[model samples]
Structure formats: structure tokens, C-alpha cells
Target: MANIQFRLQSSTKEKKPISVRFKVGRKTDVTANTGFSINEKDWTETNLPKKNNDVNKLLHKSLLKLQSFLEDRYNEALTDSTVIDKFWLSNQINECFERVEKKDTGILANHIQFIIDNANTRKVSGRNQIGISKSRVKGYETFKKIIEDYQKTAIKKQIHFLDINKTFVDKFTNWLINTRNYSKNYSGKQLDNLKTVCLDAEKLEIKTNPYIKQIEGFAESNEERFIVTLSFDELEQIRTCNKITNDAHLNARKWILIGCEIGQRASDLLNITKEDIRYKGGRMYLDVIQRKTKKSVTIGIINPYVVDIMKNEFPYKVSTQKLNEHIKKVCEIAEINEKVEGKKLNPEAKKNKPETMRKIQNFYPKWELITTHSFRRSFASNYYKKIPTAVLIQITGHSKESLFLNYINQREDKDANADLFMQFYERLNKDKEPGMTVIRNAQ
Candidate 1:
């Protein structure tokens, strides 16, 4: 039972009637009478009958009523603990009644359920709802994977819902940050979902929240990792390799090369047909609106190298996955040893069996590295080195300078800087003949 307190005293104020008094906590203070003081001045009795009465009479009656209330509460407090439990149950029922009376069930599960149901409804609702795109849904699916894995361990027999504790959160965060190596933003998203679920749990009274203080770090790490962009010579090797004999595939290679020349995401390139090309305002260009960001991007390539690839290549429906494979194969044939991101089409190698690990994507775990996105990263890094930041921003549709700079490969920067230093050293040595020492005249 809760620690009980009741204030009972007579008010000397004229015309006030006796009233019952009860207070729950230090926050709730009571006047001498059963009536509560409105702020610091007037008092109103809760138990008084509806009537027009003077202020003093009201105070007196309210105080008397308060004394009665205190006696009742004190008597109940002295009763058996089991009886107190019964009283609590009754109070909860009364609270529910008050909730119904107020008609404020907007935040109930039924409301969310209704919204979800309506979103699923065909035509009228489905099309009208703020829909998540297929790409966004794919992102959500990835997020859902983490949620499902977390639920498997966090849920317990005693709780109908997930028991969110510090341990569970710590594990999930570690899995994302250390194991999966997801960025802080992505990890925060998983935590956000957990927080929402916890709030829902509170509403349903399924589980009590213990980790109320979880706040994922907003401070970004100073560690700047970079992608490796292919050098011009390496790109030339891949482009002109003799290994590709299939005309259609060779043409696809041209498109891939064109994509490299003018940085465009694979998703955007997959839908690019001849119709998107335009010759307007005295220059030829491809007007592309990016699928991921829905940002408008235009590429103006007057170079015959790119135009020749575009013109000679017969359009083919090359899947991004297949394109990545061909690029890898072409790179291998050209003796290009640079790392490019691509996914493995093979299943996870069986533990303790090297042969089984080499198995393809069908049998068990499917893990692929170097996905198609690497090409985009490579392109951005490569061009940002050669072009001005402002011009690159226009072609790449990067709205911010930081975002544009983020794509630059740090590895490439290191290599380029080293090469520059070597060239400078060579120039200095050449200017001063290595062993030619003129006999210094005594001056």
C-alpha cells in the first residue's frame, strides 16, 4: 500500500462547510478543511452538493468534509494489505472509466492499427497514403532484420512484449557498430525503432522500461575512411581489354565505362534510355533525376570517347549485379589488382570445410562483397580529383560541399600525394646534375 496521508482541520473562515481531504504526494498539499485551496487564496470543496454559498461557509463545510475523508483513508490504511490490493483494482477501473468519459483514445493501438489497415487498402487508401518507395522499403527491410534479431533475444517468457534492458541494447548497438560496421546514423535508426517499441510497450503495460537513458552518440568520429578510385591507366586497361568477345557484353562494357566517365548511380543508369539524351541551350546533355535522392543531375560530355561508347553500344538490359560481375572479370583479365566493391554470388563457405565455402549463392549463407554501389563511389572519387568542386557538385547532384567531399577516396589522396612528392624530388635532382660538382673557387 502507498504511504497514506490525510489533512483534517476546521477552517475558521465564515460560511464554509466541512469537507473531506486527501493528498497523494508532497506535490499535492491540502488546506485545513477537506477543500483544496485554489492556488493560495480561495478554497473549493469537492464533496459539497451543488449550491450557491458564501466563501467562509464553503471553507467551513469543505474543512469538515476533509476531516471525514482523512478518517476514512486512515481506517483503510490500517486495514489488511489484501484489502488495499482490492481497492487499487477498483481505482484502476475507475481510472479506465474516466478515460472513456474523456474520449481521448487517439493514441491507442487501435488507432495505429487502423492507419496500417487503411494503408493496405487498395486504390483509394494505398495510393493516397504517404507511401515508402521501393528503395526506402529495402532500407526498412535491412532495419527490420536488426529488429527481428534483437526481438529473438530480448523477448522473455514473463513479458508479452520485448523486455528492453541495457544488456539487450548494448548487444544490438555492438552488433551494428562493431560487427556489421554500420555508420553511426544507421545504428541510431535501429535504436530509434527500439525506443518507439518501448513507448508502445509502456502504453500497453506489457513491460516496464529500464533503459530510459539510452542516447546514441550524435558526435561523429574523426576517423575518415575513403574508397579507392581506379587510376586512368587502370580504367583504360579495363575498357580496352581483349578478353570480352561478346558484342552485346562489349557494348554493356561501354555503358559501364560511360558510367565511370560521368558519375551516375547504377539505379539511375539502369533506366537511362536514348530518350533521356537532350541537345538544348547550345550543348548536348543527359538530364538525369537520381532515383535515390530525386535530385536533378545533368552530364555534358563532348568527349568522343564517351560519345563513341554511347553510340556504338546497342542497348541491353544488364542487371547491376551482372554488370558488377563483368567489371570484376574484365579487371582480372586486364591484370588490374585494385580492390573494387562487388558482392559474392556464392554461399557462405561451410565451417571447417574450405571446399564448401567456395560453394555458390544457392546452398547456405549468401555473402557478397564489393557491391554495385562501389562503382558510384569510385566514380565520385576519381572525378573529384580531376574536376573543380563546384562543377563536380553540379554533375553529381551533391547539395553540400561536405557531402561531395565525403565521396573522395582517402587512399587515392595518399597515393596521389606520394606520387606528387616523388615527381618533385625527381625534378629537383634533374635540375642539379647528380654528380657534377664544380670546383668551388675560394671566394
Candidate 2:
């Protein structure tokens, strides 16, 4: 067993430094600085601060945490039969306070590499069998590449942890937006990943810039961009278009129609197989587990067009990148060329050339805006008015009604509200007796 207590050092009439005294067995005793100070009158014999203010509250919390950490270290050392001397106790205290020094102390790039390696191979704590997803590993790799590029092009030198001050953060953000041409949301995500890495490094006793906590990342405002979704007429036009002759284009069109009807993500939509479609009680249904959410959904196959596709061969194994490209080409050929406002990367813009970066509000042809994801948006938007919101959320896997509504871009229209009010009124009056009608006079 080890005994630990907080004590005050000898001083004059002013404040004195506080220290922790540790005693293990009868032969070993040591004292380590708590790195805190207070007036002699402000501390009580119970080894707790007596002041009732914010500063005292913070000191109290730090002391409790330090005590807990030291006790844990002491218990672990006991099991290993480690030396219980003053030097060992001092080293433990230094580790708790993150006072260790190393030759590679604050290399930002090295810390990022550590994070990437850990994310790639590490499992969630307490879940020994499950490792992190490959997508997350790729995300960390992407952020590492961005940092390396910035270091080479902008700074021309390696960045240290201490170099990540507010000025550096601001410059990096500007470079991401103006030079890299990244959207505000995506830039924010990258900055957030960097922040996460910094935090993990700090936990591992690595010194870092204090100003990292003071920085704020960019966020997207609702007014900055519009949520684009295809209307019912546009989807109908794509379905009835006769200009498509190429087999690849025809396959892309069929997949788009299936996606709009099923409302699953492209990752899950493109992987559907004939075995996933089942016949139950003489009705066809799609049984699928969403790849992203892992939530199983059973969709009734009622659309004749979708049934016809299923009767033949469905879900042609198309790569997501190729699907996006082919879908845009199919939409363009169908003459779905209405002008719609959205965001798109400028083809001619070169990174590191700020002059070529365009503002986000440039309108483009809707066919050019169509991607693999547009089908899901089209399905959610077109069917929301016809089905109950809760039922639709079950199919779309939306956890909240507001989020589902926003995803479909379905704001409350005045005509729709009036129709709902009339339906409610009719329902309420239908149960009334025959002579219960009231007459009103017009002014």
C-alpha cells in the first residue's frame, strides 16, 4: 500500500508551492511538486483548498484527477514488483503531468502518421473482434496527404506541434478554400480531423500549441446552398425517354429508376442481386440490409417498371464512379437540361491559383448536376406527399422527421397546408348527426 497526501512547502507570508508526499513501505519517501500554489491561509488541514471560487474549483478538480492517476500507477507497479523508490515515484508524477521530453517531441507530420496507423489497425476499446472501417482509414490518409501538400507548397518546411497557432490555422483554412477549392463543409471536416489528431497526441504526453483550442472551423449556413432534388415530372421524363440506345446507358437508366423507387444509398443500391428480391404470398419484395446503417428493410415491389426490370436481370454490377458518370450522360441525352442552382467544381481551376476559383452560386444544367445520389433524393421527394412521414422514414432510415423533410427539400407549401386543414375538418364533421350543420351569413 502507498500513502499520498497534498502538503504545502515552507514559504514567507505570501503564497507557497503545493507538493504531493508519497510514502511506500518504511524505507522510501518522496515529494513531487503539484505545480500549484496558494496562500497558507487558503488551505485546510484536510488537504483540500478552502477558497470558494472558480480558481479553487479548478485546483480541486486537478488535485483529485492527479491523485486518481497516481493511485492507478502505484497499484500497477505493485503487481510488477517494480522498485518503489523516490526516483520511481517522481517519474510517475512527471508522466501524469506530461513533463517527459523526447527528441521527436513535436513533429506534426509524425503525429499524423501515428494517428493514421492506429486508425487503420486498431479495434474499438473493449470490442476485441471489430476493427475500424476501411473508409475511416482512407479519411485519415486523405487528411495526411492534405497536410503534406500544405507543408511542401505553402510553408516549405516541416510543421511542428507548436506551429499550429491561430495564424497557421487561419492560413490553412484560407488555403483549403481558395487554393484547394474545397467546400466549406468539407474543409471544416478536414480541420476537425486535424484537431482530433492534435488532441490524441496531447493525451500521449506530447506538447502542443495552446492556441489550438481557440480556433473555430468553418460551418455551412442554410442560405449558402440549395438542396437540389428532381421533381416528379423530371423523373417521368427520364423513365419515358426513347433516345437511349446504348446498353450501358440503358442499364444506368434502369438502376436510376430502381434507386428512386427503393430509396437506398448508392453503395447498397448498386449491390442488389436477384436473390435479394423475394416473392411472398404472390407479391414481390426487396429484402436488403443497408450497407452504411446495417438496418434491414423490406420494400414492397409494386411499381410495374421496377417489376419488369426484376423479371429480367437487375442491378448490373457497376462501379460507383462509373455509375455517377453514366447517369449524368443519360440525363443529358434525355434532354433534362433545365437550369438549376447548385455547387460544382470548376474544371479549369488549377490548385494554387486563387484567381480561377469561382463563387459557389453559378447555375448549371440540371442534367450536369445529376449524380448517383440524386436518385435517392428524387425518391424521397416524390413519395413524401403520397406516404406517411413515419413510414417513409422507415424506408429512408432517417432517424428524425425534420432531417427527412430537409433531405427531401419539402418545405411546407401553403396549398398543402390548406388541403390538410380541409381534410381534418371533413373528418371532424363526418361523425356529427344529420341536423348538426350550422349556417353562416356572408358579410
Judging by TM-score against the true structure, name the best candidate.
2
Off by over 4 Å in 1: 1-129, 153-168, 175-226, 247-252, 281-283, 338-371, 410-443
The 0-to-1 C-alpha lDDT of every candidate, in the order given, reads 0.52, 0.78
Cα shift from native, residue 253, model 2 (Å):
0.5
Cand. 1 TM to true fold = 0.52
Best candidate (score: lDDT): 2
Q: What is candidate 2's lDDT per residue for 100-124, written digit by digit as tens?
A: 4533547677777776666646645
Estimate the lDDT of model 1: 0.52
RMSD over all Cα atoms, model 1: 14.2
